[model samples]
Target: MKTKVQAGGVSQSPVIDIQDLSLVFKTADGPVNALHEISLTVQRGDFVSFIGPSGCGKTTLLRVIADLEQPTGGRIQVNGMSPHEARLARAYGYVFQAAALYPWRTIERNVALPLEIAGIGRDEQRRRVDQFLELVELQDFKKKFPWQLSGGMQQRASIARALCVRPELLLMDEPFGALDEIVRDHLNEQLLKLWLKTNKTIVFVTHSIPEAVFLSKRIVVMSPRPGRVIDIIDTNFPTQRTLDIRETPEFIEIAHRVREGLRSGHD
Candidate 1:
């Protein structure tokens, strides 16, 4: 899915491409615009974060990318195909804001649910479940149910389940938003490492400036209702960066720009 824009040669498509995208919801009272003229492109292996105030349509935009919500206007393509086609091709895995795990099933079984539905053999399912669980560092907890795990641990399990399908893209919607700061920081570190190892394109949704700065290669600052793209800020930090990088002036500078973009959009 990497962009192969060769010099004087044919160019490959970006991982995601959106052009003048818009969406409106039909409500009891009237039509409510959720997104307006949203245009952005994501390259393979890049990490992008969407951040905005509450009700700003960050999640709505993400859902559009996932094909969970259909757009009322404009166009979007995921991995050179329509979101519907890409989804059928298993081009991406989505981790929702909540863990959304079933307490009835053990961690391994939960992770295997998709594989099961795909009609994968038990042997291959076990292999993928084991592999992804180990990647998320949840191998030891494979036998535990969702209720038995801490919120962070359960979220990790949810991540493992998402990764088991070996998707080219990962869509995470505030996956750690509800966690304690200490735990969230730890997960951010781990997630960066995971991205480095897998080289998968990730589109994450978050409301935290620090979290977005820490994890994203590019941060898309969004406006209020009828969400518009206010600014797209790039973080040039190395992939191997630690949490300590947040203290650097470079990090703070970028965060300031993102904040200013938000404020200007409101104005």
Candidate 2:
């Protein structure tokens, strides 16, 4: 069931609404504060990137939004609904650093996994699977197993699987972090195309400055050691950005700004 919380009344009803989010883990030694009082608002159809150094709470924040982890303090609402409720409704699709595709499942079956869990009809699932494969330019690899594909191809399959269910929110945590620079560049371009085509709200976490700049409409820079939002930079780049756009002065300027944000967080 969809969330009952109304939008626009409280803080404009962000696709992701995080307020004073704090996380702590009690261990044998003492309490470990993983996230500080971090707050963010991600609007519908917005592509946002979270960039921070190691030990920062980028992934933890994403997990909280995905309902995989609970915050010790603060609240998160996805589409005006609680994260856990939204997760139960399958309101978002998640792609992790690794593709995480099952070894035994073929590409099509893997793509159809969510639909199967949602109890969608076979014919509808088949159609959606085929459609998303085509969207990711992997329609021909429908029967291929995960092992049969290269890292890039496997990530593509993972993306296809994530989109097969037509989720409104896409949570990607360093999906291309494992690929080489050249392959990562290629996938970045493809991801931009897919983002435009689908118009889904994307929350991507990455360490690469250029990658984050290229893929996001806005970059959310977080501080290390009790992570918090240090800065948010908007990239007013054209929607039809290409490889040549990366070399343009505008792109360099944005990258510089992001680098500055990252540096400021450490000081």
lDDT of each: 0.92, 0.90
Worst 10 residues of 2 by lDDT: 1-10
Deviation in Å, model 1, residue 166 alpha carbon: 0.3
Candidate 1: list runs displaced more than 4 Å.
1-11
Best by lDDT: 1
**Where does candidate 1 have its weakest 10-residue lDDT segment?**
1-10
Among the numbered candidates, top TM-score falls to 1
List of clashing residue pairs for candidate 2: none
Candidate 2 per-residue lDDT over residues 51-98, each given as its tens digit: 999778899999999999899999889978999999988889999999
> What TM-score should be assigned to candidate 2?
0.94
Give the RMSD in angstroms, all C-alphas superposed, for model 1. 2.4
- lDDT value, residue 3 of candidate 2: 29
